[model samples]
Target chain A: MPSLKDVKTKIGGVKKTSQITKAMNMVAAAKLRGAQSKMEAFRPYAEQFHAAMASLSAGTGGARFPLMEVREVKKVELVVVTSDRGLCGSFNANILKVANRAVAELEAAGKKVSLVCVGKKARNFFRKSGKMRKDYIDIMGTFQMFNARAIAQDAAANFLSGEADEVRLIYGRFHSVALQRPEQTTILPIKPIEGEAGGAAAPASQAVYIYEPSQEEIMEVLLPMFLNVMVYHSMLEVSASEHAARMTAMDNATRACKDIINNLTLIYNKTRQAGITSELMDIVGGAEALKG
Target chain B: MAALIQLEIVTPKGAVLSEQVEMVTAPGYAGVFGVLANHAPLLSTIKIGNLVYKKDGRDDIVMVSGGFCEVSNNKVTFLVESAERGSDIDVDRALRAKERAEKRLAEAMAQKEKIDRVRAEAALQRALARLKAAGKM
Candidate 1:
């Protein structure tokens, strides 16, 4: 049988664990708010960028930009974004699994697969897996747009130089504090959207635009800008999702710790009561024997 | 027709300016140009310079780096690489940036390397824009 002191020590240890987990949960919650706001603020920029592109392409006589060229899939580059640290439950694991599956699927189709890992977790995994083109680690300690721009520039350079014919991004999309879903989006070789009318000279909006320099010049600048917007949005989403995942994971740990402490406290109290009762019974038996 | 147009200057960080303005004059790559309400639907790439806007008979200055601007339906949106308000800019920081860019340019010229000229020129423009906006130049 365990002694009363042993039960007491176990309860103390469990209580300490509860405190630590509770602190971690609070910290994660604070970080989540900042990340979520950053993600929210980026939506307007992305939407505006898309709207601009839509009207620009329509107004530009629908000339095919170089980034929008569709070519046979010879080589593909997968830009995988994962968390730098691990305490966030299955956040990193889930994203890494999906990325690996994508790579495998692409390879099976006879297309060469290369990775541009944006986080430490992804870098480590791809380093072991084989054929990692670039690993961007420890750059996202704080979310910055220039970081996104740098990555987008590399991806665009690869596509333009024919080093990689196709480019895709994989990251976790934040839905709410309780839910985050891993998502994949193709960014290279821009997909042509259906103009308002079916290949008509003028779109339905029919908004005749007067180009300052020329229509072609605007598209040339906007295409790469659009790519940068996409990458920045993805980075913000992943950052928010990581914080949310960490918050949920820490919350669960805190609850589990509380339950453990409760159980340990019950055992400790019962053990102490039993010890007290045994001492009283021994004293009573001795007094009764002396009276006899 | 609205006398004023909604001008929103947006950067990667967030929206720097979103207000109804009487007019907006930005530094276009072709040259400096002004936009008013009911302007034609147009798109132009802007260079690093001061973007001036008028509101309530008062003028506001914003510094924007290279980006694009879209005008449609009485609204002008500036999708810039970076932007800062004249009131928010630190003059000393802009001066320091100017010095750093000039030094980099001189070094590149000395080494016979054309690689950093483009970047150095851009940096110089950005610093000058900030200085001009802050009224330090």
Candidate 2:
């Protein structure tokens, strides 16, 4: 039987842990709100930009730009984005898993693969992978559009310089608090986003558009801007997903702690009752012996 | 009364404004252009400058950084990197940014630094736009 003192100490430790988890949960919740709002606000801009790109590409009718040029896939660069801190249950792990799967698939196809890790977690995870082209650390907390621009520029440079034939960005996409999944998109050699309705309907709508300073010139600037926007958008999604994952993980931990404390308390009470019952039995026997 | 066209200015940060206006004037890549209600559909790249719209027979300005403007279906939508309403701009801060950018540009010129010069020029443009939007320039 465990002693009361040991039970008491165990309960105290679990309680402290629960307290910490609760605090973390609250902090994550607060941060999630800010990140979520930022993501939501950016959605309109991204959507409009996409619509514009779709129409422009449709109207231009095969206008060739360097960024939109599809090249042979001899070598691939993966920009894996993950959170800097760990403790969010499986958030970073899931992203790394997807990225690793991608790398494996690429390598299996006789293509060379390189990595550009965007956060501390990815950097640490892929530091010894020998395929690391570059790693950006300690930038997730207060990352801005400029950070994304820098990363995009690096990827573009590598692609243009023939160091890599293709560049892909992999990050967690935040759908909701309960749903964050790893997703990958090609950032270099920009693919014009077709309208969701269908490709057939896109061209008809493009006919009425008038371009300013010619479609070719507009595309020269738009494609690079598109690349930058994609990186920034993905970064925003990852930020929101990180907070949501942490919040959910901490909440689960707190609930589990409560269950543990309850179980420990039940055991403790049973032990105490057993000790009292044995003492009563001993007293009764002593009285009986004295009377006899 | 002039026909009112829907005008919306959006940035990566958020949607700054959506209102019915009599006319919209934006700084296009080629030059400044104006659109009224029922204007033909057009897409154009815009530069860092003031975007003025007339609402209630009064002029309201928005400081827009580089992005795109689309006019369609009697609506004008601006997708800018950053935007500030004329009323929302802090003139003093804009002035400070202008001075800082000017100093950096001068230093870069003296040192013959290409990269810093470009960045300083961009910053200077943004500050000037803000100041212009606020009618301080």
Q: Highest lDDT: give the candidate number.
A: 2
Q: Highest DockQ: which candidate?
A: 2
> Candidate 1: lDDT of B68?
88
Candidate 1, residues B26-99, lDDT tens digits: the string is 99979999999989887789999999999998888999998889888899999998899999999999999999
Q: How good is the docking of model 2, by CAPRI class? A: medium
- Predicted complex 1: CAPRI docking category: medium
Superposed Cα deviation of residue A204, candidate 2 (Å): 5.4
Q: What is the two-chain DockQ of model 2?
A: 0.79
lDDT by residue (tens digit), candidate 2, A78-168? 9999998988999999999999999999999999999999999999999999999899877776747778888988888888888998899
lDDT of candidate 1?
Answer: 0.86
The DockQ for candidate 1, computed on C-alphas, is: 0.70
Q: How many residue pairs clash in each candidate?
A: 0, 0
lDDT per model vs. reference = 0.86, 0.90
